[model samples]
Target: MTFSADYLLDRIRLKRRLRIWQGIGILAICAALLALAARFDVFGHGDHIARLWVEGIIRDDVARDEMIAELKRDPKVKAVIVRINSPGGSVVGGEALYRNLRDLANEKPVVAVMGEVAASAGYMTALAADYIVAREGTITGSIGVLMQSANVKGLMEKIGVKPVIIKSAPLKAAPNPMEDLTPQSRKATEAVILDMFDMFQSMVMERRNLSKAEVSRLADGRIYTGRQAKNARLIDETGSEAAALAWLKREKKVPSTLEVIDAIYGEEDLWAGAQSAIAKSFFDKTLISKGLSLDGLISVWQPELK
Candidate 1:
């Protein structure tokens, strides 16, 4: 009886060792697969066209420039489709993205498809594309610049608080919230807005092939439906992603059989997820603070406060 018991105990120990080894082997295989996917972009692989999404507010660090850089490097990507759904944001951010997309267009065919609300700076970015497509109900075309300031003197007085600001010149901080805007300060601010507005006008006229008078008529800081914009010659066609893809194949000669890859940057694994979350949080905070203050110029459309 003792000998039989000893043999059974030894067998159980051997089985446990095999189970552990099997688990380790499985883990090793999974790690190897993930490594391979990263090296080759296997999970997000495509042969010809690269689809990039430009959603939310247009920001500097939303992986847009990085994605364009990647597309420039990859020779296999024959064309690009930029999908936009935004109300617009900072002027500089929009300008940077617009220029980058234009640079990419010089290399390969680039198409911009507007989603629900691509206005202001969002429309600016779309101008960089070789062809622009919009849905019939898509809201677009707020071709203007805006500068705003708040007078909080009453609120400060009510709260028993006084804040003082020192600047190099009266015009340096022309639109301060703590004081009433002087006529001189207001004029200075208006001049800055006019300069930016002229730039915006020029870009639209040059890109959309509209005359100065035509652009002047459209640059009233008013939003338009896609049908209205198409009639006004601001956008090329009214359609969805499928129509955009069809244009790629029919006009640009990109193969329909080629896989369409979403080439947005920072779409890796868990580490990428955490990084994107942190970056998004920072962007949100910055946008909110900027919205509350009037420190800079914006190419955004602010709807009426009800």
Candidate 2:
């Protein structure tokens, strides 16, 4: 059977189109299978582990709050590991997070793994965990409270800057650095700071089971190495997260089969964090990328002063 060239060309084109469609159909079938497997959790077990990374200043922000809330609500999650590398922040902010962590611990095994430095309020939150682990050289345990104010009175005088204030109360501008602090105001502020310090001491005592005297000695706003913390009975152990998980399994009988899930801040959260990083990057390259910088919000519990 002799065929025309046009007919043969059309037949070839039709075959090529059919092959393309067949390839697409195969791809679609594979995709459908994958979707069904994912939907049914075919490979998904009850081991829905989650992790939370608490880096830098432990701020009283929506991101941190939402993470805590999700951890509490996730039933599939057997335990939570809070990876802390903060120096700390506002006394109230640290306390709020500590309280939240404490509550979360009650429901599930919440373990804390200290990164390079978890001092002051950072350690305060760590105490709320069922177990606390630190690296060998980890600088932890700056158990204290602090209030900082810039005393610009000297600079103001040097620059011939005289400030006039109108306030309802005598102590309204008590912490004004542009002027000399009155003895009465200093005393009042000191009293308030002492009260906060006392509360911090109390929280430490409750968590570590240390007597008032023990806590007082350790809570003198000092940083301790992981070994020192262990010796002082401040930290439960001196190790990493893996060691902590092993301990939990052996000592606490958390079961080896219990899944180890790192509670990440989710991909959606990544968008916001990325946005924040981009915004911060405009001011300084190291601001968002590195840990130490003076251009941003400083954590109150941070021991190192630049």
Among the numbered candidates, top TM-score falls to: 1
Deviation in angstroms for 78 in model 1? 0.5
Across residues 1-306, which tens digit of lDDT does each residue of candidate 2 receive?
A: 899999999999999999999997776566555444433346675865456777677666665776787778777777788888887876766887888888888888888999888987788889889888998799887776655678887887789997777889978867777667889889988888888888888888888899999988888777889999989988888888888788767766667677664443423443333333233234333545555333222225553558
lDDT of 2 at 124: 80
What is each predicted model's overall lDDT from 0 to 1?
Answer: 0.82, 0.73
Against the true structure, candidate 1 has what lDDT?
0.82
Q: What's the TM-score of each model vs. the native?
A: 0.79, 0.75
lDDT of 1 by residue, 218-279 (tens): 99989999999999999999999888889999998988887776563655664443334334
Model 1 regions lying over 4 Å from their true place: 1-40, 43-46, 267-295
For all predictions, the C-alpha RMSD in Å is 7.8, 9.6
Candidate 1: RMSD to truth: 7.8
